[model samples]
Target: MSTTPSTTPEVRDDSRPARIGIQLQPQHAQYPAIRAAAARVEEMGADIAFNWDHFYPLYGEPEGLHFECWTMLAAWAEATSRIEIGALVSCNSYRNPELLADMARTVDHISAHDAGTGRLVLGIGSGWFEKDYDEYGYEFGTAGGRLDKLRDDLPRIESRLGALNPAPTRKIPVLIGGGGEKKTLRLVAKHADIWHTFGDVETFTRKSAVLDERCAEIGRDPGEIERSVGVETVQDAETMFAAGARLFTIGVGGPDYDTAVLADLLAWRDDKNA
Candidate 1:
């Protein structure tokens, strides 16, 4: 793999047009409703469609209707023709890394059949959410412990992907999500092709500087990892882009997944690209 020196922002193609993603929160909705929303987002020209991984609703009623992440992604692989589909961040603690790799590979083939490119971004993170552990019978380990596990498992996931009988259509892009200044940022420098985080201009700038330090220490280029942020409004997208974010995602929940918010963001994306 190629690495970029930290001294320059020119390591990767900064000229690539800004891309928009929509996180269709899979909570408090029926399967068909979620399916329709997924199709709608792709039709509206989203570059990526994301669903989060969690067993129950993260907001509103604790017992709200929700669907599993990877299963829905497999369905999305068939339902949408253009948009890239995957979890915003899959919890690495939920499944063995090898199994997760196989699952991603299968979805790659499914999505590749729809669009020639196998559009699976393996967005992963050290697991959080105590309820997911308590109810699911996973060990509720310390955050540091979980991060350690993630560090150990990533290589295994990659090896498994390479060893599969019919290999993944393409090398699945690894997207690491978190904002920890120490371990997380260092891991992002070493492993991730995309790094997703949440912050305003100053926070993003500070964390990005730290990321640059981490990348430089390892002889990798900071620009090689795409910077992504969650945006709530057009102004938010603009601010993040100015702070060096190129991939912007907005989250919408169901019951009624509104496209108006997405429309505004997409228009902003068009203006930026133009």
Candidate 2:
């Protein structure tokens, strides 16, 4: 891992083109609908297709239709040929670290098919959502304890990825989603290839500055990590882009799973990238 200090904006590759990711909320819908949305996002020119990791609906009828994350990702791996696929952020507590690594490797290979590289992004985070832990029979420990587990398991994941009989087709990109300045950002500095968060430009800037400080302490270039933000529409992405976000993710909930907002964002991405 190259950790040479990136002291200024020029040290980082600001010329990298902006990209769009569409997160199809896997709630209130059936698998067929979710699968179609995955294909639709790709046809609409989304750079990546994401589904969240959760056991239940995040809103609007907590007990409504829902699906597991990794299994659906496996389906997406075979369903779409061009789109990158993964959970927006997999909870580190849900599965054993090594087992998760094997699962990811399998999906990576599946997505690669005949292409030389895989499109799987291993977006992971320390567990939140107390209901998931309680319902799934895992301990809903303190936030700090969960962070400790994530810190401990990241290396284990990497080791397992290395030790697999046939290694992952590509070095699977690891996207760590959180903005916790103390522990989460520090872990992002040490382990993440992409960092996803939610906030206005000011909050994004402040937390990103903290991330830069974390990277500096570890002698890692901040540019090694891609800055990601979840936005509601194209208008919301402008400020974040100006604030130096390169990856913009739009989340659409299910039942209808409308892609209007995602289309608008993709138009903006095309212009920006051009």
Candidate 3:
């Protein structure tokens, strides 16, 4: 993972316009509330709606109400019309990669009811969350090991997507989340159609440079992958946008998934794109 600068041309195009995403963290709230919030965000003009992949709550009461990611996404596929639906990053270890591919394809079809193209973004990453691993009986291996698994399984998932009986309605976009410069960025360079991570502008710029280096090493144009940042405010989004990020997302915890600010951000998105 040496950062020795490459002489390759800078083809990492970050010229894409900004789009807003909301992570309605499936925690603290009941199913009805989560469902309603998903529908509401679609109504509010979000470009993407994401939930997280975890067995338990990430914050607030650890045992508070929470829901699974994929099943909820299936419901979202039926519940919403326009906004794209997915986990922010599905844990690669939770389900078999082939099975996960099938699930994604099915959800893709479900979401493509109106238009013939699925709105499912297959956002995935190596598993984290010790509780999710322990409670679900998954082997919580070392971080490196889990990443290795993700790297290996991604191709299988892709192959399975190709082999599915009826075939996915469209080529489902693969969004990989994480910023591990050594391994994650390289995997992202190889497989991701969208790359997501959380950091300030400086961190994003630095890691994005490393991502550029990774893509150059493999002869892939980094611009092919969208840049997604998990942001909390307009200022954060603005700074990252200035630094070449196109997708900005906010996380809203449940009980009450307040998203009034999302309207403001959506306005910002429109302004940027305009």
For 63-111, candidate 3 gives per-residue lDDT tens digits of 8898999999999999988999999989999999999999999999999
* Candidate 1 residue lDDT tens string, 149-214: 999999899899999978888888898999887799989999999999997777776777778789
Ranking by TM-score: 3, 2, 1
The C-alpha stretches of model 3 lying farther than 4 A from their native spots are 1-13
Question: What lDDT is reached at residue 81 by model 1?
Answer: 79
* Runs off by more than 4 Å, candidate 1: 1-13
For model 1, which pairs clash? 4-221
Highest TM-score against the true fold, candidate: 3
- CA displacement after TM-score superposition, residue 238 of candidate 2 (Å): 1.0
Ranking by lDDT: 3, 2, 1
Highest lDDT: which candidate?
A: 3
The clash count of every prediction, one per candidate, is 1, 1, 0
